[model samples]
Target: MGGAFVAAALLARLGGRIGLPTIPLFILAGILLGPNTPGFVLVADPHDLEMLSALGLVLLLFYLGLEFHMDDLKQGGRRMALAGGTYLLLNVGAGLAFGFLTGWGTREALVLAGVLGISSSAIVTKILVDLGRVGSPETKPILGIIVVEDVFLAVYLAILQPLLSGTNGPGDAALKAAKALAFLLLLAAAARYGTKIIGRLFDTRDNELLVISFLGAAVLVAGVSEWFGVADAIGAFMVGLMLGSTTSAKRIMTLVHPLRDAFGAIFFFAFGLSIDPGDLPSVAGPVAIAVALTIVMNVLAGLATAKMYDFGRGPAGRVATTLLARGEFALILATMAASAGLNPRLSPFIAGYVLVLAVLGPLAAGRSDWLARVRPGEPQPELVGAGK
Candidate 1:
């Protein structure tokens, strides 16, 4: 654990000197020193850091929830939903098409659709903070899209699990879907109407007690959410959302920074540790095609979002690049596919695809201005007439 932190920090510092983002650097550190690599293995088993990594994800989303107020949702509710729906339709739909085109089994294709569809919430949240764009106009839609994806994930998992298991009937899948929807609605209602009750729960003056109270609630709620077939990240996020309305939101935010950064680093590093560089070579061709597809689709989605929100090219570029990385969810799907014995090639394809984008996403987002300048546009009326 100590070695993981030191290595990530050192690599991130080196990358910072060159204006590179810390996210990929942290993952790179883990890959270099992990068991898969032929070098000094800091932790032989990736599972050793699983608990810490999970905490990192929870806190990251929790912080995101705190920062996202209920008013933002109220203001952009319909637009946000439409934008998010558009993004999913383009990316996930493309993924399904690509999956079928691969001649892989139907189950493998379903896994690929999810792998190609969703963005990494952890990486996206981290990029917003690192780039100092947390409060930027573009971030709201980006976050809203993630919220929509989270809910979609719950439904998708319910559908996918039954198919993969091959034992459960449609009734079972429907039951899971209902439970997931119920849990989400329950949390949404709490965020809407139970702010006072939640606020009082964390109203203690002592910092220690306050921390324990909020942390316990987040983790407990997150665990229960998993039982209800929802992603724990959303659970933690909803906890943050509910508490965000309370007077203590600022206090919780201030206290969670170090925890989020520390655990978040661990999450990325652990992700890298699970990848075997050896597995990437065979899937290089497919991975390249998938990466290209994801980039193109994200740009279109970004433009669509910008048009909906009446934003300029710069904001469009931010939306496209910030949501480029694919991490935890892809990995989870890969793991599930492997367990279900779907296809031998699916895991390697996902690994290579994720590794490429994990590095590229942050780099592109940091330089999103390039996309704006390079994009073709009609000449300005003033410049055209004056030059003429």
Candidate 2:
């Protein structure tokens, strides 16, 4: 554990100096020092650390929600609906086609398609925030779309559990689906109503109290989601989204910022540690194809969505380019795949691909303005609040 911390810290510091996201570097370091690599082997028991990593992910989503205001959601509702819906449909369709061509079974195909259809909200939001583009007009719709996607991911995971757990018959599947939907509705209500009450409790400006409250809400929601047999990350994300609509979300974020960073760092490090090098050689080809297809389909989907929103080609292109990277959702899917015993061969490849995209996406976001400027026959980039 001590060795892992020191290595992670060194990698993070080096990554910062080179303008790379720390997550990828942490992953690389883990791969190097992990059981797979020969130079230095530092393996920690994952069972001991999984809870901490999970908490970190929860805090990460909470911070993402705090960054947005209710008005952002209200204003971008239509765009989000259009963009998120279309993106999911197109990417899932593409994934199904690929799966059929690759000879995967129907069930596996659906799982694969669902995995590919989702982009990394955690990664995208973090990149946008780091780049100071979170408040930009382009980002508003993108994030709005991501918010919707996060909900969809939760629902999808709920649907997937029955399929993976070997619950037979269409009746069982339908019943599970209904139960999942009911649970989701209940969760939304809790976010809307329960968070409001929780928000009021933070009226006093005690930072420690605020942090505890914020984390407590995350755990409560995650626990409830798990009890309902839905994915914990989904529950945590919903909690954040609910708090996001409240005026005090930002204050809570501010209070928990340090904790979030520390735990979030550990989360990424754990991600690194989880990659198994032995599996890479076997899955490399398929994983590369999957990653490439994911980037292409998502980018096109983003472009199509941007055009529908009446964004000019350059801005639309920027949006498409920026949205191509995947991170958190991919990690979540990899975790699900591992749990299902579906295909351990594919998980590390997907994880590595996601880490690579995490690095690339932020750099693209950082260059979006320059890209827009350089594109011919494109309108000037519009500031996020200009029209509003």
Candidate 3:
């Protein structure tokens, strides 16, 4: 594991020098080193690596939530909600249509919709950082879309877990959905209202105390989320949101950066670790089909979202390309589907789609400006440099 991290760090540095994103490089390394690649740096116990990968996911989301600012939310206001809602309907609809056309059953189609709809928040957030786009005007709405996406994801899982367990009927599924929705509402309320106590807890400049407090809070919240059957990444994100409401958000962000980088790499690598190379070629056709459809829909989603919100072409392109990748959540859906025996072929299809998109997604986002300008007779907009 230690060697894995060291190798990941070296790969990341090399990728950086070549203007490549680390998200794909990390996963590519995992593929090269995973158990599937016998005689390589094989992960002997993938189950154990998965547990740590879960941790990596939690911390990665926590750090992302920390990057969001209240000002952005407040400033973007209603446009964020409108854009996010529209984006969801469009993308999810595209997924469902694709699934049905491919002859999947209703439930399987819905699962496929989920696999295609959600963007890789961890990878996308990392792209924002690597491209120095965090504080940009376009980012506010993108983050808003992510917030909405997470909420929908929780609801999807609420219904999915029971669906996999074989719910008695639609009413039973509705009840579970209600419970999940209630939990999400309560979690939001707590984060929104419980700022004073949290603010005072680590208001002092004691590095040791602050570190312990933040880490412990993340763990406690994530553990509680697991207890409630919610995704731990969502739980950690909420914790980060609560912390973001406080004055110490900046301090926490600075402190958490190093940890996020290290663990985040592991998270991406572990994602690749779970893939079975033998299963991929068989599913390549479906993977390519899904990827092609998603790319078109994602671009449309971004364009429509930006136009509706009155954003410029530059921002619209950013939204479209940034969303081209699907990641951890999609894998979770695939894993659950495989375990429930829904379809023997779903997992490989998803893994291949996600793996390909992770690489293409970042590259697309990094060059969004150029992609947007590919339109005839349209002059490309100038990119504002970082910190400008």
Cα lDDT, all candidates: 0.82, 0.69, 0.76
For TM-score, candidate 1 versus 3, the one ahead is 3
> What tens digits encode model 2's per-residue C-alpha lDDT throughout 115-230?
67777665676667766666665776787677667656767887876676556699987877777678878867766667667567656677677667778978898888766767
- The estimated TM-scores of all candidates read 0.83, 0.84, 0.85
Model 1 compared with the native: what TM-score? 0.83
Q: What is the lDDT of residue 286 in candidate 2?
A: 70
The order by descending lDDT is: 1, 3, 2
Best by lDDT: 1
Q: How many steric clashes does model 2 contain?
A: 1
